[model samples]
Target: MSDKPKTPLLDKVSYPADLKGLSREELKQVADELRTEVIDAVSVTGGHLGAGLGVIELTVALHAVFDTPEDRLIWDVGHQAYPHKVLTGRRDRIRTLRQKNGLSGFTRRVESEYDPFGAAHSSTSISAGLGMAVGAQLSGKKRNVVAVIGDGAITAGMAYEAMNNAGAMDARLIVVLNDNDMSIAAPTGAMRAHLAKLVSGPTYRGLRHTAKQIAKALPPIFHEPARRAEEFTRGFFTGGTLFEELGFYYVGPIDGHNLDHLIPVLENVRDAEEGPILVHAITKKGKGYGPAEAAADKYHGVNKFNVITGAQAKAPSNAPSYTSVFAQSLITEAREDERIVAVTAAMPSGTGLDKFAEHFPTRTFDVGIAEQHAVTFAAGLACEGLKPFVAIYSTFLQRAYDQVVHDVALQGLPVRFAIDRAGHVGADGPTHAGNYDSAYLGAIPGMVLMAAGDEAELKHMVATAAAYDQGPIAFRYPRGDGLGVEMPERGLVLPIGKGRILREGSTVAILSYGTRLGEVLAAAERLAAFGLNPTIADARFMKPLDEVLIRRLAAEHEVLLTVEEGSIGGFSSHVATYLAANGLLDSGHLRFRPMMIGDRYAEQGSVDGMYGEDHLDRNGIVATVLRALGNEAEAMRILNAGRD
Candidate 1:
């Protein structure tokens, strides 16, 4: 038997334009095939399994009704777009999803014409979709615009902004609330409760509308009191008049899994004219997948696994991942200090705050994909003398740069930023890489930055951040497993602006930070084979620059090299700036080359694959060091050097 899925109707769909001709019965078959294909594809490739499975019917219904590509479709936080990708001509390459030089795990504009606006970040779809809608109207496009947002994503302030603006303008836009009753963790807040009431009520919508029309028809003298009474009653009955008052024709609380209800409602919304509309479709996060549905996070995004068994592939080692290490370290610190509370931007599970959330439910705050708010919220918590660990990925923290600078740094809040994914994040690609955290964070005054070389270093860094109460501090760690170094049962706080010398050399010094130390040490070993002893210094802190150790090394060595896995203005540049300013330039023929992720949008690849492609791997580092040391002949001997 062949492994190829039966794509009878799905194979026929070359574009959304072909979808309109299909009968409702035929479309239902297409949805079934799409779901099966998605499950099959994910079972092999293993990226974003649950989210795509949840939206199979909705994807079918949207394409079946709307003129996508011509009419814009923006998918919020795009993990749900695997089914959308499969339907829109990427089905064959689906098995290569999230792999190097293959289909993206999330929606991409370059991948398809159907995705008018691409999104990997959550809560951005509504705002971007609104922009497309407004732009379309301005340009006389008159095309339909829709933003399919998750209920979890709906909590962000920007979503409310788009809703408020769209409602006020009455723009011809469709806001499909894909309510799975969960974000990464279970959904929280008053807004979630409001949505629950709307879904639970039987005849509240009918009664509220009848009263509204009656109030509008009342006599002039009684208009004011009647209007006030109607407003009060409307608020009492329909829990979603908040959206209604903003100008959206709210019609939903419909079963999203049911094609019977979704198709007709989407069709009606597509045909309707005057203003913005909200169609609340109740969905299960891992609908049709029993194992995923049973999981706590609805298996929101999963690693590669066996489809039949629903078992993820066994890891090669029992070593702890950088994320788990950070979680354990933080938990240890939080236990000692009750003032240390954790905050995450709709990524409790992703950032490993879920562990913290489980232990201290009241202390862990999941701020719901609002990176900007999470930063300022931490600042607020800090103002009240609470120690807040704002655990955010480096990529997501980029979204709140202004907040970090203005709110936290300016006010001198002791916000301990547990920066996860601080280097080349494989598979999820450039969009998810934590490549610029060092440079950006270093730019702020009173901001201390550190990176971990291994799990033991990470534990100390965590303790350092917790102990520092003067200003904001951040500790960055990579995505995957640590180097299997023995972790201390308890952490020790390292001195600020201090470093340890790993190897002693006469001519050249290789100053490295974070996870790049492992590679630097490997390069040192290779150089040692050639009777070249290179001094390797582990510069623990980025901001303060470990000036004592650097100055000592710079004075003795004939050549100096700074290595970091960030961009242009990172640690290397900072070292250069400090050397130049302090008149240490021209000392030992000072060779400053930062082995960092250069200025480019990197593609999906393995860690080594991307590192080599970008020329930031250990061999690249050795080659760059050799060239800087005026040993070009020696540099050529470094096996991996290519492309100048």
Candidate 2:
């Protein structure tokens, strides 16, 4: 009675082993069904739709030919692993993708044995697979290690490092370059152009076939030369010369969508006793879906959508997003200062630099998925007396810490870091959580770290970063929409190491950093209902500690609670350390508490849901206040009462 498409072939073949028993034609039918299933499941749950659809045939072919669970098949970025997940006995739970306590948006090793190495970040698969291959070889175990990486991922320097090492190691490894010619954004740099050229070049099918026949007829001495000639002939026409030079046996610009082209080529690669192999498969992103294929980004990530209309379901929000606020604020700053420029690592649109790019086309720089290079590049711009705002998500910026420390912080370069998603980003899960930036960056001596309380504050912080030339400064804002506060006509740069009191109260004081101020305010109102009015203050700067304000609050209030949307050793930790080191806790009259994200990694869910689960929401905050007031039983009762 259900309206879901009948996946008879897919249902019959639950696992890769089941697929091996089917004929080539039947396997092609299975790929079609698999593609349909992925679309349908994504329509229900909303996730990385296009990437999964693009790799349906390739997923089937790889699993069918190779022995998975035994053979390590690592997927780069893991956005394209939905079809792979479905084939690996996870079809029953496929529709729960990205939901609370359900499947992850990206591949996770804990989720399945099929996924050997967990990956959400790009360009890590090759390195992981190579390590596995080398380990297996050393351990005297017989198993294949295949790394399915995209052209976008391969552009990262880490991929090249892995390839270079793998090449020299001569380990039995297979690197499948899924050249869809698109990352999240359109691929950038010379590598993209090179991949495009290789795909459009002369066919290597005839040359490869002829070379194989000739090699079969030739003697052992001539075989090596004949093989080298074959490689050279293909390299000459199709441009896999770079891969060949890396000591990989290069094969194909094969049609990834076509099972006929894919199965045989994959079979040969699997059977071949080569040191290392690189298989180039040309496929269209969002291959089977018309709407996804026609879209600019190929619907790389999507909200739940109507399967028929392909119109995604977007949650209505009145407030502007934090990303847009940052973009507009930066743009306004740039209008006055000609030296101001913007830089992003692959995520021009995601980081809101695409708008900056439109206005100041020459000034906006997208350095691909290379964060390490992007940071040092911004440092160089800063060295030339240009104010460079390096806008990157906090999770991505973690990849460039060395550059931040050595090139920027150590040298005291004034490169502005605009860290977006500076809290627990829902749906994408722990892998993409921006929870550690505050703790990590705050540890650097000269680094000025600030968090925005709202959209208006974010604008001010942007202006503050633009005006500050003291040293390397960073500002963080959470994901999703603002708190619908009134926008300032123009941004005003607040004094460094300053905080503002929102309310005046006696018994308890709640000091908040970042957008968690809203929740703190709500909790303050709840406490007021229980005959307890708490003082609320927004500590603007995390690094400088706002010692004057903190010491005054500690001396005046009976209970002082420090709240932040970060890990343990963040704003709260700094406050606690400052309070303790200065002997503020010697009196024992003041009860100090630091509320933050706990010691464990949080699961994917709605932002509010995650916050509530972590007990950092309004109710949770109120409960913390109750416990601090010596009503521990009452605090537990309030928390057990449920969501506000």
Best by TM-score: 2
Assess every candidate by TM-score: 0.92, 0.93
Give me the runs in candidate 2 sitting further than 4 Å from their true place.
182-231, 296-298
> Candidate 1: worst 10 consecutive residues by lDDT?
182-191
Score each candidate by Cα lDDT: 0.82, 0.88
Per-residue lDDT tens digits for candidate 1, residues 400-487, read 9999999999999899999999888988987898899888888899999898888899999999999999999999999888887887
Model 2 superposed RMSD (Cα): 4.6
* Candidate 1 wrongly placed segments (more than 4 Å): 182-239, 296-298, 637-644
lDDT of 2 by residue, 1-644 (tens): 19899988888977889988899999999999998899999999998988778888999999999999899999997999999999998989998899998999888989999988889999999899999999999999988899999837887899989888888877889999998863322323434434333432233334555668879897888988887786676676555778878887676666678776677677766766656888888778898899999973738889899989999998999999999999999999999999999999989888999999999999999998899999999999999999999999999999999999999999999999999998999999999999999989988999999999999999999999999999999999999999999999779998999999999998999999999999999999999888998999999899887999999999999999988999988999999999999999999999998999988899999989888887889989999988988899988888888654
